[model samples]
Target: MNERVNGLSETAVKLDRAGLDGMDRAPPQLDRLEREFQTFMREVDEAAAQLRLKAKPIWFGPVKADIDAESALLKDERRKDPPQQEADAKIIQPERLDPSQENGKFAAGSLKSMDADTGPVRAQPQPSGAPKMGEAEKAEGGSSDVFHRRLGPINLADNLQAGIRAVRRNLLVVMGFTLATNVLVLAIPVYLFQISDRVLTSRSTDTLVMLTILIAGAVILNAVLDAIRRFILMRTAVEVAAQLGAPILGAAARASLHSNGREYQTLGDLQQLRSFLVSGTLLSFLDAPLTPLFMLAVFLVHPDLGYIAVVAALLLLVIAFINQKMTASAFHEAGNFQSRANLHLDSMSRNSQIINALAMIPEAVKIWGQDTAGSLKAQVLAQDRNVISASVSKAVRMLAQVAMLGWGAYLSLEGQLTGGMVIAASIIAGRALAPVEGAIEGWHQFIHTRSAYERISVLLKSSPLNFERLKLPRPQGRLDVERLLFVPQGTKRVVLNGVSFTLAAGESLAVIGDSGAGKTTLGKMLVGSLLPTSGNVRLDLMDLRNWDQRQFGENIGYLPQDVQLFPGTIKANIGRMRDDASDEDIYKAARLADVHELISTFAQGYETMVAADGSPLSGGQKQRIALARAFFGNPRLVVLDEPNSNLDGSGDAALLRALSHAKREKITVITITQRPSLLNCVDKILLLSNGTVAMFGVREEVLKALAPLNATNGRPAVASQTPQVA
Candidate 1:
């Protein structure tokens, strides 16, 4: 027994290196004899035959060699203990081997059983003499999965908090530059005081030259600091945009998929935030609180002058507050009206051809005008209030200046104030009130931006998609819907209910139903474009949600009822905008769908530019090209809705050929069709009616049952072909 074990081990080693060198190799007949010892090898051969995998001579030889080596090991073990085999069989039960253990040599049957779980069984290669994947492998960039950007809980507060964090990251440097610029601005008032007091009183050329030089230097320093501060703010805005861009855009896109109209407007809010960051209006608000510094300087000059400055500042602030209170409601209404008008404009523009064909342009124009009118009226009312407050604020500011001069003249006569001191104090008072005036002027912009921020914050806080999802391998296209139900958001109406079916790999099912029968919704759920409200849609027993969407999407082919296309070249659309899509696969898909000749008719062939929604092509041309895209990469699962709606006799023939080819290639197909001619290509028929399954059965049984009913009664042919659910 020991001698036989040693000989078989040596034989296995020789077989592994058989093709490596030109050594005179022994005939593999010795290994073939070993194959007769194992019952598992015979079971595997039968399983492979059931799968219908054609065995090429070249491929079969290598497989036989491998089986031979495995059999040899088993034969040597059996020789060691003939009687131990029956007893050891209890210990070597296939059920005891973990399905996930790839190293289990006698667990081949476990591979087939792994499909009982919710995911497809995929074979992973274990490199000979290689260490197992671990933290070291992960650190070396071995993981292919990526973590998506997560935008935490959707809400206004969280959005604001995110913004605050970004700002605080560089707040210290920004603050330093801001304070320095403000301090340099003080030099202007000080220089003016010295020029009036020292240079003017002395009336000396040397004193004037020295004061002028000092003031010029201070002005240059202030300019430099102001530039640096502006640069910092701009850089901060860019960084904030970069950090939050992906998450915000992803949230918006996800919301849009669920028909959240407000989500589309979220992008506008992001723009507003970016604009506010770079705008000087926010900076003016920041500097407004520093106004008291100027007021204190005035007090140092003379108590009477200081009192006037404080009263003037308070009056301006009162007018500003009045402006805000009067215009807030108006501005909010105006924003809502503007949003509706924009939405209407977008819809009308997209459907302009239909409006013109129906001669409804005048009606559309009137409706649009009405929407715009409401927006305009609100704007005008807000503007009227703004103008009134602004007028009062400006008049008070001018009045304060004139009154200060008059009061100074009186004080100078009494020898309580100098002329230079009065001039300097008035300038300080005006500087202190400048921010108030600026705020009033920019109040409307601030209101619009604030409203945008609140709307966006809410969108950002709404639930986000799961990032860092498990990366499951490609499915073999077995589809299962377990009592699935789907109800759209904010609606009690159910789109689909209690829909259950099973499609084995490489089988075709035809879904036949009238309008509003939930056929479209079923197709969407199967392709993972929409989620079921309850129950599950699984591929290979695993729920679709559990599978990584990006990888799963690569194995799926979907054709929507509307036949939409993006703005790009013909080649790009067919390739689904994949950068790695080969020209061979693209051309092969085009040929399979019989669109190659049609595309060649165009001046640029594959490079021809396609308008959005494939608007540049005729209905038949669009459907054919879309079919070609669905066939791209020979995807495992293909779901086509109303595919032949626009196709002519020739196009329908081409579609039939494509379906036939897809079946031959072992692709699973679920096609929704209004025409009965398509039934010949499908093996099973599913009839849907009013969100429930009317019938589901083999194609022949359904057609035979329905034909007799149609012959006896005057019922519609399509309905007659459908029997009650069994």
Candidate 2:
């Protein structure tokens, strides 16, 4: 079942690589090789898993096979007997004895006695499921897929139209400078063409001096103008990238609650958007039609030769296009190989101890190699195409040059063209070829940038969560849910079916349910992270959607399951959402989150910078920073999702104290917890069951309803009693 091909395996992998220096070196080639190896390992892993399954071929038991055959034979025999006339009338409602009630519970086990849909659903019952969806609190940033499919090429006409329409005063001034610079640059070529011919014919000193001065002036002006153009371009590119990235980052933020982002997305995807804005969109405008203009002009002067030049260039480019089309499947294969290869590497690195103990290093490498080989082959084929194309173009250019030299010799001898003219024509032809290759390069760049641009656009274009907008009510921590139904992700069963609950402001509420129960989804809706498909969620007598973001943000303090910290001083992070807050305010918030002491212990105290995404901090430390962020605006509602995940004992107690302090500050706290101890701390509990509130009331009352649904290690004592939330 091990699919790794030996013999050439070691030879195929070129582990040691020489760095690029002087000639005979390239870095990208080595990188490609390494990537291919990694890709092979990924392929080997997947294939090995599949082949292992195949190797253990299933053998239908002899008796079972015979039973199946006999069953078929008996069915045929039954068919040969005339079909029973009353076969369809075999419905039976067998009489059953009712079971006795054991204590307050119904002890009868027969499913036939139960009528699940016999009456109206409970209008106001308690919720019993655990509120927290996952035990771990997540970091603050949202993850997403790497490649987002675009809706064809972007219609730039809209952006272009708007740009022209919104031609602001500053932009017009910059445009004028750009136009003036272009005019000056274009005039140089014309000047050269005219002066070269005239100087060759007459050899006038005055003419030469003037031409020299003109060229110098043009060069100087062009450089200065280009600097300005670059400045403008930078501004424009940043504006566009931001215009594209902000909404995308926003969407990613919006999607963070439901998506863990492991499938196919990363921060790199968003960076691609920025890159495309600066390079791809701006450069592609020249990719079309410019060649035709040059060809038309050339044809007017030399009908046959111009046509040949155009034909040859066009034919060369056509080959490149064909090669690109052929590489699509290869590129896709390469991408898959790359992803799996990376995963393999990550797994190997993270589980080095496991591999070391098993002494499976060679096997691990071999597996990685197996995953990556196909992609390597594809890439090798692609590289071959590129090299061959380059070599062919070089060959073709040689032929054309030979022809040009021969033609030029005859024309010079006949006195139809001068030696200098022949040289000039040859130079012009070479210039034409330079751009042809550049055109192809430009095309390649376009495809890359376009790919990235499309991803950013998708993030921007998605529909936001639905929340009905209503006027703001001073949040008093009170909440109510009536006739609520929730379907947790990846399951057919509902976690909360016909659930209802109510809570007073400045009070604490705990949601408890089975692991898959819709506890997290319910909490998410309350925090404006998700919208219910078929119900209304209101906050403080106002619809969530009705309030502008500023108002909602100012009033609702939501702590996500994952707490992500930006790379900055502790004070800076707390003051981020409240720009006007001073150092004292940030310190106060940090103190409330119980992280001020930790900040003080750092070498820089409150000024110590956290590495990007808080890599320097432990999970517990990161969560506290996030809690500090939640407290920034003195919001009335404190919604915590698994805040105690990384804390233990005294830490947990301290976190609970913070929650209690929030309540004392008149801020309502709704927390999701699976721990029984945390439940005891809350005033009320909403126990969720089968996508409905099983019970809702004071903690003791809700616990009574959920007594039958207690679980161990997150699984129900009985399968049917468990809610399918995940």
Candidate 3:
């Protein structure tokens, strides 16, 4: 062992000397040295293993001393030449060695001559047909793929399936309870049979008392189990709601965006689904499958009685099928009419003030009444059919019970069955048919719930939930629009086309055009509220569509033509309803919008509650607050459409101040306006004519070009074209 160690030390010294002298060693010599080093390492490993095995024995002391001495010698040698030892450590570090380099003639650190001249080893060229590390994991669908799968599809069916999976254990437990409950249902019939066969025949008071107590106990236990089953179902409904509510709402919101102002009833649909979960209708469906078990029980009592129960159940099912066929179309029509009527009523309610002032209530009511009347007529037809079917089903059930009793009595008289068996058969037969009757009675509810489920599924499929995007750094306010084009959904009319422009960081541009020039649409595309049919809107060279929505929103501020505030405190509205927003941010936004003093005059100041309709605050106040909301968090870009339309003189002055503040902060600004006041504050002007760019250049240049047209037309050229821009 000592001789081997000496030989290894001598070889290392020779290698270090060769490296210090910068001698270019041949590949063969380096390979030979590498083989020797590997053999020495293997020997050291074998010696360590032997020492470990001998560690527990009395002879281990000499081996332990030899191990320590070897370790000390290695440490002393490492200290003698720290830099060389460091290079050796690098060679031994598994992570530092490139696996691809292993196939080359010289292994890592095999050429000691290069160690003195090179800083770190370079990666070797990979062999042909070999996958890079990243490509290999990508091919195997690694962590990123797993993340995407976890996101899943945002459709209703997948979300519902996920929710069901989450509660699968609870569902299994509920099924167990249902089975026990159904089995306990036989206690009534058994008690009746015992009373007639034992107590009546014996004429024993003690027997009657014992039978009463047993029947009472069974009834009590059955009720307890039923209660527990209902309780579990109710809790399951809540859990499902908690799991699905947010995703459903998010999908609905996205659906609304692409729906051309069509409103979705998704929340109502979700509520209906939750209601169905805990309804008696669900319990009836659950028990319907167990009907055959009850029929089997009746068969055990008497084969003739079992046959009667089966026929009755089959008859009721046939009736249910008939009822569904008779009313399905009517229920579907009613649902459509009801949805239309609701949408009409909601629109009317939002415009109630206008309707009343313009004496349009009668016209509005007439239109709404037509839709309501159709809905009611369809509902009436469905109800009529439902009632008739239910009545017939009830009659059939009663007659079946009577027939069972009559047959049992005849069999008893024939000396084939006991009297106690007669009443028991009647009760058990009724229990078997109860679920079928319940199904008939609740058929309308089942239809409605099924329709709701289908509608929700369609809504989700039409507008899938947004997946998480990678967060990019905050933008520096540079804007680029490249040949952007937009056509509204479901229409052939092009709203905007071939609109292209650029704005450096902190530059401001005013968009001026005719009434139908697509200015609002362009604004929406710029802020990513509306997607373009082609081309791109880029901020900091990253496409707007690719930016993480929440992060992107944080960097951009937008005030639309109609400024509608959300229902919350003034402070919340300014902070975009984020709970984490600090008071300082809210105040800063308020001050930037120049509405801080107006807000302070309010009794609640920043805490003042505001409605969605902008009550308690005037139109000017609402517009100003909305401006503040857009300016919140010191957004890199701000877009304002008709910002001063409702502003008074003071409000207009405040708007100018806000624009000046934005300029000082180097925030990019885009305003859609026909007002000369706004144009004066902008660096450039984009004149849109019929959705196409008419002129785009420095503000003074564009205005000078329009000067002749204004003089010739006897009016301001932009304002004459845009009569709707107040």
Residue-pair clashes per candidate: 6, 56, 0
Error of 1 at 547 (Å): 1.7
C-alpha TM-scores of all predictions: 0.77, 0.61, 0.77
Write model 1 residue lDDT over 1-726, tens digit each, in one string: 455456656766766677656245545544553763254456655665433222111101112234664466448546745674543242222332333543555333433223343333333444222222233222421222222212343233444567668777665676777767766777777777887888788888898788789878988998997788778788877876765566677667767778735467667777877788778776777668778888888889998888998999999898989999999999999888888887778778778878999999999888888889999999999989988888888888888888888898899899998788888888888877877877887787799888887776676667443433344434557787889899988999988999998787678999987789999999999998888999888776578887656656766789889887778988999998877777887898898777898899999899998987576788888888898899887677899999999999988898898898887766799999888778888989998988898888889877766665555676544443344221
Over 4 Å off, model 2: 1-235, 256-288, 332-380, 411-418, 463-473, 488-496, 560-566, 572-577, 582-632, 703-726
Model 3 whole-model lDDT (C-alpha atoms) = 0.78
Pick out the ten consecutive residues of candidate 1 with the lowest summed lDDT. Answer: 53-62
> What is the per-residue lDDT of model 2 for residues 260-315, given as tens digits with 9 covering 90 to 100?
53223423554554464345334323223244544554454345446556666776
Model 2's lDDT to the true fold?
0.56
TM-score of 1: 0.77
lDDT string, candidate 3, 1-726, tens digits: 788778867876777777735456645566777888789898887666444432211111112234664467457656656774553331122222334344454453433221222222222444322222322222322111111111334244567777667567676777778888888888888888998899888999998898788878878888898899899888988887877677677676766767733445777877887898889988888788888988998898889988988888888989999999999999999988988888888889778879999999999999899999999999999999999999999999889989889998999999989988989889988988888898899899999988887776676666644544554445667788989989877899998999999787678999998899999999999999889999899887678977756668877899999899999999999999987777877888888888899999999999999986888899999999999999987788999999999999999899999999888777899999877777767888898988999999987777777877776777644642232222
lDDT for every model? 0.74, 0.56, 0.78
For model 2 the local lDDT of residue 657 reads 72
Model 1 residue runs over 4 Å out of place are: 1-164, 170-172, 260-262, 712-726
TM-score of model 3 vs. true structure: 0.77
